[model samples]
Target: MTEQEQQTEELRCIGCGSIIQTEDPNGLGYTPKSALEKGKETGELYCQRCFRLRHYNEIAPVSLTDDDFLRLLNQIRDANALIVYVVDVFDFNGSLIPGLHRFVGDNPVLLVGNKEDLLPRSLRRPKLTDWIRQQANIAGLRPIDTVLVSAKKNHQIDHLLDVIEKYRHNRDVYVVGVTNVGKSTLINQIIKQRTGVKELITTSRFPGTTLDKIEIPLDDGHVLVDTPGIIHQEQMAHVLSPKDLKIVAPQKEIKPKTYQLNDGQTLFLGGVARFDYLHGERAGMVAYFDNNLPIHRTKLNNADNFYAKHLGDLLTPPTSDEKNEFPPLERYEFHITEKSDIVFEGLGWITVPAKTTVAAWVPKGVGALVRRAMI
Candidate 1:
């Protein structure tokens, strides 16, 4: 046996089947890998690629396939309780679980929208709440109510509990959603707010954290249940290495920015989203997305060449051929007035430059629908 493997701490790269070492950044490895290896610690093995992608935003990811994601949802779907379906505000498409409504049965589903801080500053709360309700309807989930909260920033978490208390009313509460939707983060925030920062019983991070259902005592003798996260198909998380996911998932409040684009100018939101106003003059195109997503501007004429040369280097997460494996890109066009929120299905949104016409495109299977301007 090799000295490294013999040390009892070896990490395998699930993505490329490479033996991870601590020294390489581009290769499959991380600093933590070696430490764990020497101690023979069997930590969750993610190569440097996945590590950086998960923490930074250098790479784009491939989402999980439908069948695989459904398999993960089996337990929650069969759970005997109320379901709180949490989805990321940035990548609603990546967070959606199809046929979830059918599996809900008599238990009412609560749509918990996480990462509200990633939206543009100008977005009005009432408008956003209304839009969220419509989007949930489109997904065929009649959520008893839609609550927006940022688990990272601890926004509206208390209100979320109040809503839960009122609606759930003395029954089991199952928090469910696809991976990377901040389900774990949301749970942590709720626990911390309801309890305190120093609460000893909370599992703060990682996916499938509550590997099974975890029940916590409630005020009236009911219970708050935490369920394992199910991987949702089409999320960039599956496509990206852990390193790349952190880059795209916003870690803080997003600042909305404005852009001046002429007709046929294309803007790429990393590799995840592309916006082109097919036929318009240089008006304004404002973007409301994760602050981590780097915005690049170029003419539509050179958009293809730019992407070809810069796929992973620039236009990321949709990484090389990530979207091509899926169906064609779905096209959506919208007219602008004073202000608007352009929902890019799972990816997030770009606030439009009012009075400017624009068209946005995303992978086919992933829905790219927009509601009334939420700003």
Candidate 2:
């Protein structure tokens, strides 16, 4: 090929699928010029972001506008593909892609709930899957099947592959999810299981790690596509710094903490969320959060002043520097007619009993809602 032709030839990142470039380190698919020559010789290439993520366990922020994601969805809508929709079991509501059913056209969706290991072991699989199915239906999606797996722990990964294999039927597969839902990790697990390659795609705790679609060819000449995670602005992850994200996002199975409270009491989940027991008889409230996160209790009347006083010191997680920039918590009140969980999206949840009236507070623009108790 001519030198100009070689220079103009597009080379895509094997990890993220962005066009490889040596210019503009801040831009997508950037790698050093020396690394480009090395990649050419090695016949294996990754962009700088994925390279750092794989080797150093470091993450860099990348932007993907809604229009870009929409264009991707349009491509999926036009393709003959099986849509494998992944969602964080902990942040189900926040992980949903808005109007996804409308975007998938006639593609069959296989709903996979990731981070299942984060839930208490006592929680029944059937019940959890039922809850997920119900939630999917509510979102106007009738998934062919629902599977629960923990990509981090490599739990139920073989079963997930089997289900995908059964449903894919020689067509291409497209895995999709909102940011921080473990989609990349799940894809990495699949790559290891299928091809025996480790960490083929970048996986990190941060949001928006995968900036473009990565296609992995199957033996049948079809491919499995890993799409960039859609940004959900309402997620609490968007508000917190990386340090606080580690505190909010649980790493292991949650140990439920039960508190006996009277009508006028409050529980602070770090400085990130609040649970107020507003009315009804004294009862036990169960909290499900990261084991390391501190929960502080105080009288409901004194909750406001207490939060203001101890926010950075005792309550923590908006750390000291973050507290000043942290958005104010917005209140969401619910009268619990039955057993339910008041979820502070991206943060953890509190299980409240029937006949209790409670209020949940999360940062403004973050989602807080009630769902049937999972445990």
Among the numbered candidates, top lDDT falls to 2
Q: What is the TM-score of each candidate against the true structure?
A: 0.67, 0.96
Clashing pairs in 2: none
Write one digit per residue (lDDT tens) for candidate 2, span 106-179: 99999999999999889998999999999889888999999999999999999999999999999999999998
Q: lDDT of each structure?
A: 0.65, 0.90
Which ranges in model 2 have alpha carbons more than 4 Å from their true place? 1-9
